[model samples]
Target: MSGKSSLKDDIYAAVLDDIIEGIYKQNEIITEKQLIAKYGVSKSPIRDALIELCKEGVLISHPRYGYEVVRINEREIRDVVDFRILIETGCFRVAAPTFTKEDIEELKNFTLNECWWNGKDELPALKHWENNMRFHLKLISYSGNDYCYRMVENSTGLLTRAYAQRFWDQRDNRAWNIDIEGHLCIIRCMEEGRFDLAEQELKKDIASFLDIICPNYARAVDL
Candidate 1:
């Protein structure tokens, strides 16, 4: 990449991290001057970063004004959660039939170790979240379906950013704690080759999460 393109990517990554870390709240106006000073870079990189964030649905741009953070919408959160359920459950269904004991142990160990970092008022929570996602990604990595895996991974960054914002505001621990148990349960079911049980637990897990993140959205599974 050219120097300009590299600079743009760096700026994009920094601004995106700030948004995900709650440095910028939803629907808040972001002035170019402020970003210019914060990043201490030329206007070119700042502009490129804002444009990319807009494409990611993390920012909204106006003709006369600069970009503003995207507002959190219950409907949008619901839609994303629904999509997650479809893709993630399908991944587990396909992978569980052949999942091995080693796979289960790896997932279990990753989650249990990561839980230690949670509940400590960490500023960015990205490390904890990344590790948590790794467990699920590993479970699906052997599904022999690259498209499904890639789609889920790509969608997760945006969805997780949205959820993290809400999670920080509400300070709800129930959903977070459930996430830990849910992963463990899924691993156990897969280890036992209980595909049906694994699918059932996966649905419930996503449903509980949807309720937390988008309470007004349609349920993922009929309760």
Candidate 2:
């Protein structure tokens, strides 16, 4: 990558991390001057990063004021959740039937691997989320469709940011443990060639976030 592009990407990630970590609250104004001073970079990469964030709907650009962090509404959250279900389970249906013994074993390792954590009870929310993404992406990869994989990847990333913003202070290890079980159940259904059942389990896994999104939006299975 070109040095300018690399700097832009790095600044983009740094700004995104700040947003996710609550350093930049919703609707907070961020100016290029502030980012330039903070990162000790020039205006070009700062503008590039801010422009990229604006394109992603993560920020709103004001002509003279600066960029404002976009506040995600409940409706937008539900839309993202539904989009994830459509791509992930849809891809799972196409992929599950083609999973080999090796594929199944590798998936099992995602949840069952001890190296990724000290123990389930002691797992960090960040690490648990990583495993969750790994399992879902791995299953989707078997579909052999690059576009579907990218869709799931991007949707999951948005959800991850939302998740951190909502549940950062409410770390419940038990809930994450339940999600791991959900992952295992989907894998079991895939192993048995029960594509329909596997899809249901995958939907439930994706819908687990509904608990955080809203009380009205319960699990997908209930809907």
Best by TM-score: 2
Candidate 1: deviation at residue 182, Å? Answer: 1.4
For candidate 1, write residues 111-205 as lDDT tens digits.
67754345634524555466556766666676878898898788778777877677667455544433466777876777777879988887777
Q: lDDT of all predictions, in order shown?
A: 0.73, 0.78
Q: Score candidate 1 by lDDT.
A: 0.73
Compose the digit string of candidate 2's lDDT tens values, residues 1-223: 2599999999999999898877887778999999999989889999999999999989999989999988776667788888889888787777766789898888787657732545666776656676778877877888899999898888876777766665543543335333577888887887887879889988988877777545464544356
Error of 2 at 52 (Å): 1.1
Provide the TM-score for each candidate, comma-separated.
Answer: 0.83, 0.85
- Report the C-alpha displacement of residue 179, candidate 1, in angstroms: 3.9
